[model samples]
Target: MKKLLIIGTMPIILDMNADSSSDSEEEEIGETEETTQKPITCLISHDECYVAPQLLNELYVEIFARVPCSEYWKLQFLNKRFSQLLKSSEIFRMRQKLGLVKPYLFLLSSGANRWTMFDKDFESFLKLPKLSSNICFFNGDKEVTSVGTQLIVIGKEVEGITVWRFELEMQKWVKGPAMITPRVMFGSASHGTNAFFAGGVKIDKNSYEVVSIAEKYNAETKTWTAIHAMHKRRKLCSGFFLRGKFYVLGGQNENDEYLTCAESYNEVTDSWELIPNMLKDMPVLFSQAPPRIAVVNDNLYLLETSLNELHVYDVNANAWKKLGVVPVGAHFTRGWGVAFKSVGDELLVIGASSARPQSQSMTVYKCRPDVEEIVWEECKRCCRGVRLNHFILNCCVMLA
Candidate 1:
């Protein structure tokens, strides 16, 4: 087959099946600097990428790693070298080592055709490529989490349940190497390159079963490894990493009983330590959303859905202290539509703006919860052109 590489209005056709081998890739790049390999300010011609050694593989990886991830799609059509480098995801690994991996926000709104992606500043936005799935996937409840540069979305379609991954460098969606076990309403959290999922409802033909199973996914291998299960079988719980431990909190047990206890997994021992009554003091409302939680500056904060209040978790005391009222209408949908996450050193909350028309715009706020007094400063200039539905269906942050 042939290939057509198009960038903007210009169209360039080339052989897609070309092997395009190079000697520069074989050179050792990780061990030391390539002192003998010379650097060129620019590519002299498109053909030189494969036919000659102009840029060292280390230089290419370092240059691309520093470039904003938003511009990765454009690099795809540059040449065969750029395409292969990105497709291999070597740049992503370098980004981690260089401490250049930055977070990006992805929001799936109610009735939206595509997921909207925003930079950390929230000044600009773009729509991600639509998922290639049946209507069952879009309409059904979805669980989303980000591992490294990939966005993993889990939901049911016509073919039972499936996992779809959105690769950052490729700028497209691909059917996943499915999870170790397919489940719904699972608690998930990402630590560096690995994603943790645990305690969910595993659905089958006739009935659904609540499970205590847990699994960890390695993004580099695109593989899931089964981990030790939680002490209690729960669904609708939430998961987050705090103080180097994976914590699962607040969900319904196998017998449909509301659980206040929490569990933490220790990788050193591969066992779960159950903490009873971790959320006992908080009032449990009917059909409440799974604890809207975020950890900022090593401090865990929970968005109380019933009263739009914020509370900080005292890890030592195992208690929650109310901070103050939030500006959004979190209780409108019982906390389902709001997005709570930690972006860098601050707590970010996005939801229906209580003061204005929620259908036309979302309220964005961020605060450093570690301070003596909490102050949520709203981002008044977020994506003015595209009025987003405040009722966010799901949200995830990708560090790429």
Candidate 2:
């Protein structure tokens, strides 16, 4: 076998001949010794990438595979082959590791309340039909809970417990366990492998009274136990885990004065503390306002219902500033349905519940980093008619 190595436009040919007989042999010998050479032209924008053709493919897979996307895309324009590989499955695998695929959103439902769950780009919502009862969402991770495939509804008696579970592969809902507490207007938050339920009226109608009891349920152990009591009773209050603390905010007291107080439960010490009244310095824009909060980065954002104002509290600075207001006519329209969910780098402001005599609809707006002119748009197309209150984002199964 003969080998020829070509670099640039320069081509080298190998020739061999053996001297033999007469004039005819001399002609054959001259033809065999004749060699052709051509100069090869090549262009390169970057000097580092130059390589021989045989090793080019291997070089690319090794180089761009590890290069940051900003640098990899620049290489993509070099040739059609590189561009195709950039859009190929291998590159998407790189993106998956980078957390770039459509992120996770889990929709959770209870008999009376609904919430959306997500982290990164994924989002999901729980579906609720009209006039249904007996519902709860469960998960083991308190930091990022899942709307368990399980569903529970309480009938007229404590024994009347109905359970349902959704199988993703089969795409159907099957039966599960019965809830220990048959009540509505309760708040549920998960920590570790257990979910805690607190503060809901049993809704006995004529016997209607707010319930102050707290209970914790283990999804793994499948058991329930009553926990420490809350300092002040709260119903329809927002529940969230922030900075290793459980924050319960803005629920009605026995008199239902639209309490503007906030309380925190520490998991480390198993204690509850009343946070100082901070929003009072700001005017009471709406006496009926339901305050909501969202944590972006490490900062806490308080969405005051009264003024449609966005007050941000910096965790590092321990300071508060009113950045901007939600669009007009945003709140109280969907009563208990309003919530904030994080989508990528921004917060998704979802409007739910009916504050007025209006149809049940949901709107989601993107809260921008810019203090002025934050974007608020209707997220109905994405959320459907499902409403979310205290929507929390979590990272679970990544669905591309």
Candidate 3:
């Protein structure tokens, strides 16, 4: 039989034509030839000298963890192993453990049931699954929060309280447990496996009544438990969980007046304590829209809707310090419809700005938090020449 050794693009042929009468004679001849013959040398090209080492399953998982969530589905076509590995929760667990998980911005446009996601790493937009039914939209009063790896949307429909949970791995939405009360324009925050809902206005008759009711939903148990209500009725407020407590700040009261007071709820004691006002002299107004809040590090950031100013609440100092005004286009109206979320170390603000005489443009600003000077830089510009009035309904960040 002929023997061939492929060292590069070139193939080397070896002669193995020697014959022997017996096994002993053949063994002796082979030994003599191997000892006396000079080894053939071949020069291999740089591209064909060595092949890259195949990645181990564990290494592949680590690499996949850094990939943006929007691109995960497209990677399945590479091979079956990738499809299986991408589906496994182990990769995401590794991502979370290694701190490789990045926050993905999910935007829900008004007057449309479909959702669009913005991936900061890739700087691209992706359309997510549409709402299964029209009941998912709640006249721009829906509240959204993230619990673990799932995105939960809470709102009221004609039928009753509607809740939907979007499983990140499955990339689909499923019916979640209904709320005990059908509320709108409420404040919500999530910690661990539970989500806390705070004060909001509910329709009593023809007029709207501000309610101080509060509740927490357990994602694991799929049940709701009533928590201690806030001291004052609040609607269009911002709620967030920080340092083992839920804080609700800055909203309109029963008289439809803007509020500057803030409060925190301690679940361990089942009580709400009044905290210092976010602004000492000025009131936080949300007449045009709800205030936006994001938690970065241990500080809570509040974006005033009317003034377009950024304020940070220091947990240790127990004081609010003015950051800086976000740089929206001059033609924009008082930051009324801007959406805010914290992605990694940067704060992302998205909204519509005047592009031309009659058209609106979508703009995204990335703001860095600093005590001396917090600066806002334009990161993305989209939806040009399109009317984005009331189009951006809600925005939230999901770590993936």
Candidate 4:
């Protein structure tokens, strides 16, 4: 007879075949298996505290202290062991990053879609270039005729001379050629490592013009070439990939007047056609909002400045509704505000305080699709240690 034991206590008796091994041999086999049995252990600590129990808790602290809540939540679900370490100082920070908890919004102003962690509210983690304001980024990718990890940002130093680049991973930004003319506030979308930059403001000392010229940047070649220019010029437009096409939405003209119009660019035809205006019959109600747009659950949301009311519009439905609004003084005036979806269908607004351009604030707002009033709150603790450059909310995964 062979017997297996666990915890050096209870034994599991195994009857060896009578025709097989001797009793002594069977006992040896049982002893070997018993020794190899894995013992159940708690994630926190073990007897005598040979190792510091704070290590796991400290890991919990360090990770959340460094990363955002959305990313941290994903890591937590990687294994049961990680989720157990939720009791730590960084939990609140993670919650703040993820929009799980709230109070003071985090804001850092440099440019949208640049990755940098700040140590103070007004100072930035990245060294600003002489023409940092002239640069903007576009997301791109390769494979599947769709966008991937490619990025595009440009600087217009002198003349209407604009330059763009592609990112290799999130760490590097490779430069490309100057555009035919200098442009800013352009819209760019990706189709597999190639990003199309279109519809920006072209500047040439003492005057600026709305432009419709479109250009494409190839990540592999690190080169930018001209594509067809659109018929109309637009500035501060929203560009995104949807249903195999690049959609450009409502933007302002040269006079700073909002235009309730939209257009789509087709790669195959190298043409742009007027699509239905995203906000038809919707009058421009606020000056500060400046046609801010964000996509959530495949539905597009247009935020209005009047009382910070958020209007939800279905591009497919051609319909609209008041989704929610943020409290007054919580957001910056004339700041670039963007929305990011969290791990739990939560929506976060990334913006800088117009009151103070250098200070950035991240507002975590709950989405109430069915309710009349949407609740917006700020995460005080998460932004406590972080000073400037905001929370990397829009550009963390992207290269600046």
Predicted structure with the largest lDDT when compared to the true one: 1
For each candidate, the alpha-carbon lDDT, in order, equals 0.82, 0.46, 0.66, 0.48
Candidate 3 clashing pairs? 110-391
Ten residues in sequence with the least summed lDDT for candidate 4: 138-147
The residue-level lDDT of candidate 4 at 275 comes to 67
Error of 2 at 181 (Å): 4.2
Off by over 4 Å in 4: 1-151, 158-160, 164-174, 205-207, 254-256, 283-289, 327-346, 352-384, 389-400
Q: Runs in model 2 with CA error above 4 Å? A: 1-181, 278-290, 314-320, 332-337, 352-363, 368-400
lDDT, residue 126, candidate 3: 68
Cα-based RMSD of candidate 4:
14.3
- Summarize candidate 1's per-residue lDDT along 25-83 as a digit string, tens digits: 33221111332122232233222223334445565577678778878877788667788
For each candidate, give its TM-score against the true structure: 0.87, 0.52, 0.70, 0.54
Model 4: lDDT of residue 175: 45
Count of backbone clashes for each model? Answer: 0, 25, 1, 25
lDDT of 4 by residue, 196-219 (tens): 777887667787789887877665
Best by TM-score: 1
- What's the true lDDT of residue 259 in model 2? 54
